[model samples]
Structures are given as C-alpha cells and as structure tokens.
Target chain A: MADTQRPLSPHLQVYRWQVQMVSSILHRATGIALAVGSLLVVCGLLHLAAGEESFNYFKSLIGSPVGLVLLVGWSWALFYHLCNGIRHLVQDVGLGYGIPQFVRSSWLSVAGSIVLTVLVWAYVLTPGGAA
Target chain B: MSAKDVVVKDRRNPLKVARGLGSSQSGVGHWWTQRLTAVALVLLGVWFVVTVLCLLHADYATARATVAKPWNALLLIAFVLTMFWHAVLGLQVVIEDYVHVRWKEVVLLVAIKFLAVLGALASVLAVLRIALTP
Candidate 1:
C-alpha cells in the first residue's frame, strides 16, 4: 500500500501454514458463525413463546435435513470456538507462551473441540435424547 | 524568534502524541472483559445446551413447564444477556478489522450494538412471558 509498490512484510502466502495459524483463523471464523447462530436461538425463544403450533414448526424446521446439517456445523463451530477460546484465555493469563507449549496447545484445542462435538452429537442422536 | 520558541513550535502536542497510541489503554479492559465473559459463557453455555437437549422431545407444555422453573428462567435470562454482550464485542472487533471505511464502520458498529440490545431484550421478554403466563 505504498507508492513504491514494495511487497508487504510477512506476506501470508509466503509462510508455511501451521496449527497455530489454523487455530487463530478458526477462532475468528467460529466467532462469526456463532454470532449468526444466535439468531436461531432468538427464533426458538420467540416461537416457543408464541404457542404450540409455532413451537412445533420451529422443531420441525430443525429436524429437517438442511436444518440438521446447519445444526451440526454450528455445534461444531461452537465447540471449536469454546475450546480455542479457553486456550486463548489461558494464554492471556501469561501461560503457554513457549513455542513448544503454544504449538501443543493449538493441537489440543483442535482435537478437544472435535471430541466434544462427537460427544454432543452422540448424546443427541442416542435413544433417550439427553434425559 | 528565539531558538527555544522555534523548537516548541515545531514539536507535536503531547496529547496528540498520546492519541497516536490508538486507544491502547482501553485494550486491556476489552481483553479482560472478553475473557471474563468467555469464562461465564463456558458454564452457562454448557448448561443451556444440556437443558435444550433435555427438552428436545418434550411436548409444548413440558417445554413451557421446564422453562417456567425459577432457576431455569433465571439462567436463561442470564445466558441471553451474557451471550449478546459477548457477541456484540466479538462482532465489533470483526467489523473493525475488515471494514476500513470510517463512516461505514462507525455506522455498522452502532447498528450492531442496537440490534444486539434488541435481540437480548426480546429474548429475555420471551422467556419471561413463557415463565409467567399460565
């Protein structure tokens, strides 16, 4: 963005991608996704307050294939953001700053989020449905 | 006319120099609040998910009854407030990062705050209605 047209420092395409990078990017991506997902929460509350018919309509919408897919994606996003968010909070407190520890924690966040998503879906898809 | 006067005239204002720090003093406050809300949401969000899952197959009356429980109603309201607060903070940062046009960015920033307030209020009102009615 200078008059000389020199290449920018630390250009993204020049660097090799790493877990730390992916984790950082996912934090932003998932944050945006969760923000959008909040609308669904509002809708659910509104529908429930409206009456039985409205509530059932909301339920059926969520039970549909497209809705199920969105739910799965949003849930994974929520878990990813949650796991990475904790890692970020830990880092904010001055822990896990070393290169080795940071990289390890990055991978931990990713794996932990996946495990959580699987566990949640397992519960939701099971017989009793989280009784 | 004097050398001292020339030097003073050429120097930038101290307040202007400080302003160049670009609101760094408030950065820590923002960071801390985001983390604090994250911690709160971690607990509240997990509880909410579990509660909703429990209501997944419940009939209308059962769902209403579950929300009508005092503790459930309180936590739902708390969750709505915290979630929207955290969300607006997060979205503000996202917009600031990607939207460089000053006027548009300011408009969007203000608009999101208003919309979030409305969303949070509406959600809380809906919860109260379900809890208090019949």
Candidate 2:
C-alpha cells in the first residue's frame, strides 16, 4: 500500500509487444511452472526410493490422465526454458543485439523448443528403446 | 610487498580496484554453473523425455525396467540431483531479490533447501534400489 498517492504514469500498456518481450515473459512464466513441477519429481523419487510397492503407487499416479496432462505441460515448459536459456546465454556474449537478430533469435528459441520436444516424443514412441 | 601493492594501486583509481570487492557478482561462476547444468539438462532432459515417452504406452514392468537400466538409472539420478540443485540456486536469487519480509523469506529459503535435498536424495536412492536389486 502506497502512503502517498499519485496518478500512476501510463505503463506497459503503451509499448508494442515484441518477440523478445514475449520470450522474456514466457521464460519467467515457464520457470515458475517448472518450479512447481519439481514437486512431482520429488514425489517420483520418494516413491522410487521407498520400495517397489510405494514406487508402484507413484507410477500409477503419474500414469493417470491428470498426471499425463501435467507431465505434458511440464515437458513443454522445460523444453521452452532450455531453448530460451541457451539463447540468453548466446546474447550474454554480445551476439544477437541487432533488432532483426533479436527478433529472429526469439523465433529460433521457440521453434527449437518445439522441434526438440517433437524429436524427443518421436524417439520415445518408437517401438524398441525404452518401450 | 608495500612497493608492489603501491605500484598496483597507483596504476588505477583506488575506486576501480575497490569496486570489485563489493557484491557486484563479476565472476562467471554462477552464470557458468547455470549454463553448464542447462547444457547437461538438454541431453538429460531429452533422454528423460524419451524414456518417459516410451513408458507412456508400456505396462508397469516395462516402465520399471526402462528406469532400471544402467544408463537410464545413472542419468536419471544425475538429472534429478543437478536439476534440484540448479533450482535452489535460481530460487535463492529470486527470493533474495524480492521477499522483503525477512523472517518469512528466511523460512521459505530454508524450506526450499530442505525440499530440494529431500527430493534429490529420494530420487537417487530410488534409482539405485531399482537398478541394483534386479
């Protein structure tokens, strides 16, 4: 609560949204989601460690419909963060500062995340391997 | 020693040298650690996703076997440990930056650490039990 009141200056609404902004916003958004998702990871570990019966319960819980949905969401979030994080690292080295470069890189991050996710799922869905 | 120290100081403004001492976070240690863990995750995460994806259509035994593989077990443990560690580091910065309520912040920080540790330990041990027992 502000003790002194003043007319709030016109803010974020005034600016045009850009890809960098979108990715930047999404990065934080995804980070928060992943943080929450970490709890499931914890549960999985605890179940696995406790022994086969307990771990079986954990497995069943995850194999449920709701668990599948949460997993899909978190998988996307993790991939998005991974791709965007690499992009930010590149930018840290003083590359991709140009407006065009910045915008394109944002798309690259998004595309890369989707592509990676697809590749992973594709490999997973294959007949042998882990299946 | 005095002459050497005086000569170094004389070369630049004392402020310039002194500035490094403050919490400016100049080194790449944190940044590098974050990126390094990220790079590891890209590989581990993809592997993990693939592992889970395969398990998606599999029965309980199949899924359990997949996790019980030597490579899968080791990587799974590594992935969980590194991920939680990275998360704590990330959250610590976020909490410190915000969370002006000092006592609340302290409790939250401690809680986060405890949870991460508990999570990592459980995951690793789980992987071990599965992999080692059969």
Candidate 3:
C-alpha cells in the first residue's frame, strides 16, 4: 500500500500455517460474524414481540432448512469465538505464553468448541421419549 | 542524524473554543475497550450457547419454562448484556478502522452503541416479563 509495490510484512503467504495462528485469526473473524448474527437475534425478538402472527412467520422462516444451516454455522462460530476468546482473556492476564503452550491451548480451544457444538446439536436432535 | 525540526507546513489554527472537531489520532482507547468487552463476552457467551442448546427440541412451553428458571434467566440476562456490549465495542473498532469519513464513522459508532444497548435492554425486559409472569 505504499509508494512502491513492495510485499507486505508479516504476510500469510510466507509463513507456515499453524493452529495457534488459525485459532487467533478465526477468533476475530467469528467475532465479526457473530456480531452480524446478533442482528438476527434482534429481529427474531422483535418479531416475537410484535404479535403471534409475526412470531409464527418468523418461526417458520427460521425453522426452514436453509435457516437451520445458517443457525448451525452461527452456532459453530459462536462456540469458536467463545473458546478462543477465553484463550485470549487468559493471555491478557499474562499466562499461556511460549510456543508450546500457545499451540496446545489453540488445539484445546478447537477441540472444546467442536465437542461443545456436537453436544448442543445432539441435544437438539434428541427425541422426546429418547431421553 | 539530521537535527532539523521542520514545522508541520499548515499547523496554524484559529483560536476556536474547543480543540479539533473529532477524536485525536491516538487510537488506543478503541482497542482497549474492544479487548475489555471481548474478555467479558468469553464467559457470558459460552454460558448462553450451552443454556440455549440444552433447551433445544423442547416445546414452546418447556423452552419458556427453562428461561423462566431463576438461574437460567440470570445467565440469559447476563449473556445478552455482555454480548451487546462486546458487539458494540467490536463494531466500534471496525467502523473506526474502515470508515475514513470521520463524521460518518462517529455517527455510525454512536448509532451502533445505541441500537446494541436497546437490543440488550429489550431482551432483558422480555426475559423478565416471561420469568415474572404466570
């Protein structure tokens, strides 16, 4: 972005991909996505507040397959952000420094999020009498 | 080393009342708030998702009942408040970074904060109305 067409510093192309890097970058990305997704929550809430008809319409829309897919994506994004956000909060307190600890924590966050998300969908898929 | 203290060519200004119109170029405050809210959301956000998931597949009445429960309602309120706080904080940074038009950026930031706060408040009220009602 300077006068000359020089390559950017700390660019991703030159570096090897790592879990910690993925977790850190994805955390911010998901945070932004979840911020957008929160608007959907507002819409849903307002629709429910508006009236029964509006709430039913909103329900049907979100109950559709496409909506379910988006919900699933948002769910994962939420979990990922939550897990990595905690990792970041820990880092804020001056803990989890060093390469080994960083990488380990990154994997821990990824695994935790996945397991938690699966458990959530599992609960969602649970039938009435199957519990 | 060149010891030349050159002037900022157009650095003169009329003796107006206040300083510059907008915030200064020292942009650390936005970054700090974003991180602060991010820290709070980490805990509140996870609790929210897990709680909602547990209520999944439940009927309308069951879901309402779950939310009406004391502990669940408390966490729900906490989650919504912390979430909007984190969201407005994050969006403020995004707007500040991208929206080069200063006035527009400021307007959008203020608007986002207002909307987020309103959203949070409405959600809290809805939860309370549900929890307190029959």
Candidate 4:
C-alpha cells in the first residue's frame, strides 16, 4: 500500500490557454520577482542611511546598464502585479465573478499594466524628467 | 448476533477529515489578512513609487531631506511594513503550492517569515536613522 501509485490530477498541459490562467500565473510569478526586488529597496535604504558616499555608490550601481535592465523588468513586474492585484481585490469583494467579466478584467489587468509601465518609463527617460 | 449487528467502531482516516475543509480552522483569517494588506499596499506602493521617482534626479542631501519630512517618513515606514506583510502572505502560498516535500515546505515557510521580519526591522531602522539625522 505504501508503494501504491495514485492518479494525478489534470495539469496545465490539458487546458487551453486563457487570459484568466495567464493572469493567475503571472500574479505568482511577479510576486516572486517583487520579493527579490524588495531586497534592492532595503539596500537603497541602508546605503542612503550610511552617508552621501555610500548613497552615491548605490546610485551608480543602479544607474549601470545591467542595473537599468533589471530595474526595467522590476518596474514592469510591479505594475503588472499591482494591476492584477486590484482585479483580485475586486473579485474578493464579490464583483467580476462572471466568466465574461473575469476574462475582461484579466485582459484589462494586462493592458493596464503595460500602459502604466510605458508611462512610467517615458517619464523616466525624458530629459529633466523624473525617473 | 450477526457480524453486521456487532458494535464495531469505524475508524476514519485523519486526512479525510480535512479533505474538503481548511485544516488550520482559522476560517478565512489568512485570506482576509492577504486582502487587507493588499489594499494597504496599493495606496502605500503608489506613494512609494512616486517618492522614489522624485528622488531620481535629487542629490544626496536633497534625497535625505525629502525622506526626513515628517509625512514622508511616516508613510515610508507604513509602506515598508505593509509591503513586507503582503509579500510574506503571497510567498507563503507560492511555497505551499510548489514545495511538496513536507520538511522543505516547513523550512521555507519559516525561513520567509524570519527574512521578512529582519527585512522589516532593518528598513524601519534605516528610515528612522534617515529621518532623525541632521
């Protein structure tokens, strides 16, 4: 009995791709990313608290090309998670439960996040603009 | 008496008792906390991002002064705590779902809690140090 093989439940391979599925998965994926990003926040705070020299060094690290790439990815992830998280909160309040609404909201989260990421980056890259 | 008439107690598997229902018996506490932290994070997170953006072009003294503002310092502390709380709640679910090994799951879960606690404390101290500095 200890060696008995139990049947496995249906997995992602069996299901057709859908907006809801993608949104759900992305929520978790971006969550993990943000968890890592939080460390950077801690690092920034620590450096800033240490002194101007340390703060400048921290700024340089983040201003480097590789750092910029990671920052871009992190910002996009933050936007996506925030948008999708709002959708989830709405669902928690008992709205948007219908299939059509669920799908629509899923897509809305995706689209809204992209729009936000673009807006933020646009401001970031513009001359004399806030990053 | 026949075998069917005998008063034999039927033992049930413990796992079966918790099969459909929540095991912790906290009855939605975890779910509610996750949502509450999420809502708090939404407002705090927006403020935090904007604050960071404002600091992008700021020099060290300027950035320090910005963070030293009473309102900014208060909200920064609020943001750090809420963000870490929400993060732990979310990560716990991810670990529970994916880490099938019982020992590994428990260790990971406990590890995250400790890490979040340490991160929160360090962040708060850092904020206080910045805010109180001349």
Question: TM-score per candidate, in order?
Answer: 0.89, 0.75, 0.73, 0.90
lDDT per residue, candidate 1, B36-63, as tens digits? 8999999999999889888877999999
The regions of model 3 sitting more than 4 angstroms off are A1-16, A47-55, A128-131, B1-40, B69-71, B98-104, B132-134
TM-score computed on alpha carbons, candidate 2: 0.75
For residues B1-134, could you state the per-residue lDDT of candidate 4 as single tens digits? Answer: 78875765556787876676764675378888999999998899999999998888999999999989999999999999998998999999888777767888999999999999999999999999999978
Model 2, B7-124: lDDT tens digits are: 6646777788788674666446766787788778778877876676656665556667877888888889888988887787777766765566678789989999998898788778
lDDT of 3 by residue, B1-134 (tens): 34454644445564352464446544567567767777667677667666655645545566667777899879877777778887887777667655666688879988998888888888888777767876
Go through the candidates in order and give each one's C-alpha lDDT.
Answer: 0.89, 0.77, 0.75, 0.90
Which ranges of candidate 2 are over 4 A from the true structure? A1-16, A49-56, A114-131, B1-27
Question: What does DockQ come to for candidate 2?
Answer: 0.33
lDDT of 2: 0.77
Q: Write model 4 residue lDDT over A72-123, tens digit each, in one string.
A: 9999899999999999988888999999999999999999999998998899
Worst 10 residues of 4 chain B by lDDT: B18-27
Q: Quick one: ranking by TM-score, best first?
A: 4, 1, 2, 3
Instruction: Tell me the DockQ of each model, to 2 decimals.
Output: 0.50, 0.33, 0.34, 0.55
> Which of 1 and 4 is the better model by DockQ?
4
Q: Model 3, retained fraction of real contacts? A: 0.18
Candidate 1's C-alpha runs over 4 A off are: A1-11, A128-130, B1-11, B14-17
Give the chain B TM-score achieved by candidate 4.
Answer: 0.84
User: Worst ten-residue run, lDDT, model 1 chain A?
Assistant: A1-10
lDDT computed for candidate 4: 0.90
- Binned by DockQ into CAPRI classes (incorrect, acceptable, medium, high), candidate 2 is acceptable
The TM-scores of chain A alone, one per candidate, are 0.90, 0.86, 0.91, 0.91
Best by DockQ: 4
